[model samples]
Target: MEQSNTLLDVKKLEVSYGHVDALKGVDVTVNQGEIVVLIGANGAGKTTLLDTILGINTPRSGSIQYNGTDITGRSADINVREGLTIVPEGRGVFTSMTVTDNLLLGAHHNMHESSDKIERVYQWFPILKERSDQMAGTLSGGERQMLAIGRALMSAPRIILVDEPSIGLAPIIVNNIIEILVNLNKEGYTILLSEQNAYKALKIAHRGYVLETGQVVLSGTAEELLEDPAVKDAYLGA
Candidate 1:
């Protein structure tokens, strides 16, 4: 891919916790206006990679380039201001806060100037507006997921890293989440998605990577991966 079109690029990325290496020289990239998915089983280092990219976990080696600039080891807040945002696993909403408060928190960079963005998010997710005064903790699993995506959208980010968006929801809810993500990509949001639900994720992605034991085992277009025997056996229930 051309450098100018690459929105997020990670090469030889490595991360560790004490002696345990969570990521092992992984390489992944996302281009502008595309949905790139990283699919693997639990403990396949998907979340670690997302966390590393978001600057929540420091990489021990290699480079992370966002918009062609090295952002490796930058603070999470700094990355946030540079139009990189993450809808973390488990829908990390503030349980004690109201829906509006949680959505407003996403625009921390310039709170006073973010009303328009917040309104846009509300428009994308009218349920959030309806529950504006309700505590975020009370929303159902699907509603919480919508709130998480809406909160991420409130920042008007160019690229969003979404981890395990379908973790604990019903099949119908998973479909809803998948539709929202596909729609976001159609609206020109570059997405790097980490998901265990390979079938659904790959269906919406333009390209995909299969991560195993902290290393990337395969990379190709979504159709290629879907047709691969190993992928079909391991993830697609074929």
Candidate 2:
């Protein structure tokens, strides 16, 4: 995709917590409607990068642009309202809240004005609709993962940043979540995904980046990454 069409752009991003630098001069980009995967081991700064992009953590130095507009140092609320949303690493649903209520929280800034969007979410995950009145904490792990992704969709995000979506779920459940993400991309939403399940993530992704210690060490098409011997040994368990 062309630079003009890039939906999310990061340049020389550097983030630090106290004296510990989580990200060091990292750069990444996600074009419109593309599914870009970021794969790496623990402490590779994947979460920090996503959080920085969404304005949760301040970057010591870097530039973030969304649709050509500089969004560095912006607030999380503003970013969400501007169509950048995240399905966090852990299923961040409110355990005490009903399924419906947890989903509604995604549209908090809009005062619940988008019921149609909620219906669309239900259409994507009918089980969520079936248990709309049930407490979120009562749902199974896979169900909670679905709810997390569904809640993110409630915001009508243009580009979603998903973190470790396959963590702690069974293989079948992981595949289900992957399919949902693929379908979402097909429907024109761009995604920047961070996953430890490199095989699955790369299979669906158009392109991928390999991060090591906060910097992009390798970046290529999904097929390229899949066949890379280094990637195979490190991430694919080959």
Candidate 3:
């Protein structure tokens, strides 16, 4: 990739809710075709950062640039149309809706093309096809995660902000999710993953940023982070 091939760039971001600051001057970048993971504990501002990037949460001060265009504080719908999408934490599927209907909802920006978009999502997740007519509330956690990802894929996103794919999943299911993310990255989808499962996140990430109390405490190539004593002690439980 060229030096200028940054797909998503966030600089000096700060976000607050009431009097509590959630993020403080954070900087992160995801290059084209790269899988960059953000590792942090709960309340460490991981979700806040992703939400800011997706425009679900507005930053108090910062710049978010996508494809070289300044998209800071744009509405989430407009940002999605610009080829940025998020598979939110807790696998935000519409529980009462059928799998197919939920997938169709993702194509709100291109409703007329929704039917055409679904087959691609089904191909990525065949189980969703089998459960197409079934209510999403009936699906397992793993299946729901798949549906969430598939729904995001319906938009044909350029950069995917995935928040904690491992939450509430069994080990095997987490592995499956990780493999799916790796496969998607191989297919050239840029991914920005926020994971509290630090060891696993670092293993799959090309590069990583470690956040603590709304500040970026550390950042490096994944290999460098994995071998760092501080990372091992704090996050890896080594």
lDDT of 2 by residue, 68-174 (tens): 99999999999999999999998888999999999999988775657898899899999999999999999999999999999898887999999999999999999
For all the candidates, what are their Cα RMSDs to the real structure? 0.9, 1.0, 1.0
Number of the predicted model whose lDDT against the real structure is largest: 2
State each model's CA lDDT, in order: 0.92, 0.94, 0.94
- Give the Å error, residue 185, model 1: 0.7
Query: Candidate 3's residue-wise lDDT over 1-238, tens digit each?
Result: 5549999889999999999999999999889999999998899999999999999898999898999999999999999998999999999999999999999888878887788789888888999999999999999999999999999988889999999999999999999999999999999999999998999988999999999999999999999999999999999999
**Against the true structure, what is each candidate's TM-score?**
0.98, 0.98, 0.98
- Alpha carbon lDDT at 89, candidate 3: 98
Q: What is the alpha-carbon lDDT of model 3 when measured against the actual structure?
A: 0.94
Q: Which ten residues in a row have the lowest lDDT in candidate 3?
A: 1-10
Ranking by lDDT: 2, 3, 1
Better of 2 and 3 by lDDT: 2
Q: Residue by residue across 32-76, what tens digits does model 1's lDDT show? A: 999999999899899999999989999999999999899999998
Whole-model alpha-carbon lDDT for candidate 1 = 0.92
- Give the poorly placed runs of model 2, Cα more than 4 Å off: none
- Model 1 residue 3 distance off true place after TM-score fit, in angstroms: 2.2
